[model samples]
Target chain A: MTTLVLVSHPQLADSTSQQFLKESLPDDDIIWEHIESLSSLDVAQEQAQLRRADRIILQFPLYWYAAPAGLKQWEDTVLTRTFVYGDHRYPLADKELGIVVTTGMPRQAFQRGGAEGVTLDAALAPLAALAHRAQMRWLPVFPIYQFGYLEEPEKLQLVVDYQRYLTQPQPDSLANRQDWFAQRLDGMVARLAEDQRTTGRLIASVFEQNREQIDQLHDTLAMIKEQDDD
Target chain B: MTEQSQWLSQQIDQLAAQQEKFTDRAFWLALKQVVAEQDRRSEQLGGEVDGRTWRPDRW
Candidate 1:
């Protein structure tokens, strides 16, 4: 599926987190749109881009607990009533809306009794509501906290995970994540030399065995529930 | 096996051992632990942790 990442950082060149994320996303099926550069966005062309994308990600550094002015402007200008919410058909219907936000403070600071006193979800409620109004599925918000404090290894992991998040199908579901890992394991096994296959098989076997046990446990729970009801 | 593969295999073995006596709670705990380890390894390998999904009701 095509993904459109509309980045709205005013000073994206100076931001470490935004730069890293932009660099990590797969270039093939993903389109990157810097909102600051779209001051004169052609409504038809922009609408066409949205039409082609199955997922739209709003990537920005959290500014005063909300998106920068550029993104808000883009939304106001591009998502007209006729295009998004009028008698005309909604071009964004059934499309997924995802938010990628970066913060200077640690994640804990955004919780209750913390410095910010408002949860991240509370801060981004408007975006979620906007997705609802536009008939789009609101995916979870991805928050990068204290980007400057992350070490090299953490940064590398973030790149890998973020790339997967951007490219993987049905990324919000746990089952899909499991499938992604399983597929990766299978691919690794396939590429192994003769002597290395044993280790790969061992790992795959563990996953299979654990899945079977989990399934059996689920069955047992179902049976117990049935018995209790009867 | 390469060092990375060996480390992964070891993790699988540990997870398998935990699975043998897995209760519902144990399963969830094990899953959480595995996810934590993956995050830790990612950091060790110079990878960053991606953002999480946020729902207002959960707060």
Candidate 2:
């Protein structure tokens, strides 16, 4: 899938989280754009990028619970009425809209009883509404809270998690996750050092075996349930 | 966990340790987590199958 990641950080180079994310981007069919970098908005080109992408990610540090002003400006310029249902043709229909939002506060702060007193969903309601109006599928928001405070392990986890958010299939189920990894296993194993290739291949083989075993068990359980139902 | 599953995880961990790149290590380690998940799911599904097989009413 071709994922379009539009990052709207004002000072892209200064934001450590944004820089880390750029480094962690998956090597695949991806298009990365920084909204603030563009001197002028090419409306047709911007719309074409939106049309080309299977999944569109809007990444930005939360500014008072909203995206940066640059993203808002881009929306006003590129997302024209006629292109997004004004002409009765939903160009973005069935495409996925994902948000990768970074917050200064911890995750706990984005709840009714927390310091921020509002959830990410509620804060980003306008974007959600836009997705609805465009008949787009809204992905669950991927929030990076308190990025500066994260230890090494959390950062390590975030690398893959962020990549998956951009490229992995929808629903984020174990099945889809397995499929995602399975698809990449061969390439990962192939990239291993010569001495480590055997071990890498062995590990991959075991993973695939476990995957198949689970599928078999699921099938068996389904059969049993079917029998019981009759 | 099954012996085989444990062995697989150990191999993955060792391979992850050998990788110099943080992201590469993360991928291997993350795959190990999914392997663990697969084992748990297999056990759950196996138990459900066993539970359904011996239902007295069905028999």
Candidate 3:
């Protein structure tokens, strides 16, 4: 089957990191659909690409904890009801949906009780739910963290990690499925399919995996914040 | 027992037992490799999920 990589970066040509990673894709049978100039995005052409591919991959740099404006627009225009989410069903149903999120902060900050005190999983809920609503299964998100400043080796490793994130089996394991509870607001995740719902259970289980570590991390953050108050 | 459930249980047990090793270089590396492998194979099968698969040469 062919893999369709739908990429959008405000200034991809300038992003050496993103540029390098984008070039590492398989050439044959892989559809490379990029939005270099969003001003000329013809809805027809974009939908044609999404309709032809077996997998619809949405990739973007994390802008304010979500997709860039172009990606958001793509999601809005291309994933329309009649064409994608209508009575017959969205075209992307059963298609593997994955997101590659690159961040400058430590990966720990994106998860609950991280040193920075913000969890990525929680921040990405709207995106995940959006995919879930489309009935497009969500593969574990691939994150490139601690990237504000990096050495050559760090950059190479980040690229490799990106590649692996795209190819990995059992992507679910990568997600800290344990926090489905600790972060729960109500019957949110519980509403997913039995198969999908396990995500929360798994996150909760992960929370149990390193109970002490997470708690300690939170405690340290608390202490630091308390000190700052004084 | 269903293989999926059993496999997940085994993994949970393995992770639970290897508590002290969570922060170790070996565990993270192993987990990274596993996630990639799983996601890649699912693509091969054209699973209902949609994801991107890029190779090193492409970059």
Candidate 4:
């Protein structure tokens, strides 16, 4: 799927988390645009980009529990009523709208009784409402809380998690996650060094075997469940 | 973990350790996680199948 990642950080270069995320962006079918970098908003071109993308990711740092001013400006300029729901043509209908929001506060801070006393969903309700009006599928928000404090392991995991949020199919189930990884295994194995190549292929083969085994077992379980229903 | 899964994890760890790039290592390690998920899910499904098949009422 073609994913359009619209990042709205005023000082993109100065933000370490944003820079790290930029470097970790997946290398396929993605169009990354920095909002503040654009001198002028070409409404038609921006609308066309939105039209072309299967998934539209609005990525930004949380500023007072809302997106930065730049994103709001882009929305006002580009998402004209005529293009969105005017003239009865809902061009963005059925498209996926996802959010990648980073916050300085901890994850627990966004709860009802927490320090912030507001959830990410509550903070981003306006965006969700806009998605609703356009008849788009609003994905569950992907929030990165306290990005500065993350250690090596968490950051490493974030690489794949972020990529999946941008590109993988909805629901984020194990089956879909498996398919995502399985699709990339060949390319990953090919990239390994000569000596490591054999081991990579072996691991890939075993992974595939495990996947097939799980599928077969699932089928068997389904059959038994069906019998029990009789 | 099953013997096969244990072996697979070791192979993945070795491959990840050998990778020069951070992203490549991340890919391998993240994949190791999915492999672990696969093992856990397989075990759960296997157990459920066994439990359902041993029904004394049906016998």
lDDT on C-alpha atoms for all candidate structures: 0.69, 0.93, 0.57, 0.94
TM-score ranking of the models: 4, 2, 1, 3
lDDT of 4 by residue, B1-59 (tens): 98888888988999999998888899999999999999899889888888878879867
The CAPRI category of model 4 is high
How good is chain A of candidate 3, measured by TM-score? 0.65
Candidates 2 and 3 compared by TM-score, better number: 2
lDDT per residue for candidate 1 within A117-221, as digits (tens), equals 888899999999889988998887888999899975466557645655666666545445545555555654555456656755776665555445444554555
Better of 1 and 3 by TM-score: 1
| Candidates in order: C-alpha RMSD to true structure | 11.7, 0.9, 19.7, 0.8
Model 4: which residue pairs collide?
Answer: none
- Per-prediction TM-score to the true structure, in the order listed: 0.69, 0.98, 0.54, 0.98
Q: lDDT score of model 4? A: 0.94
lDDT score, candidate 3, position B36: 40
Cα deviation of A59 in candidate 4 (Å)? 0.3
What DockQ do the predictions score, one after another? Answer: 0.05, 0.85, 0.02, 0.90
Interface RMSD of each: 16.3, 0.8, 18.9, 0.7
Q: What lDDT is obtained when candidate 3 is compared to the true structure? A: 0.57
TM-score of 2: 0.98
Please identify model 4 stretches exceeding 4 Å from their true place.
none
Off by over 4 Å in 3: A167-230, B1-59
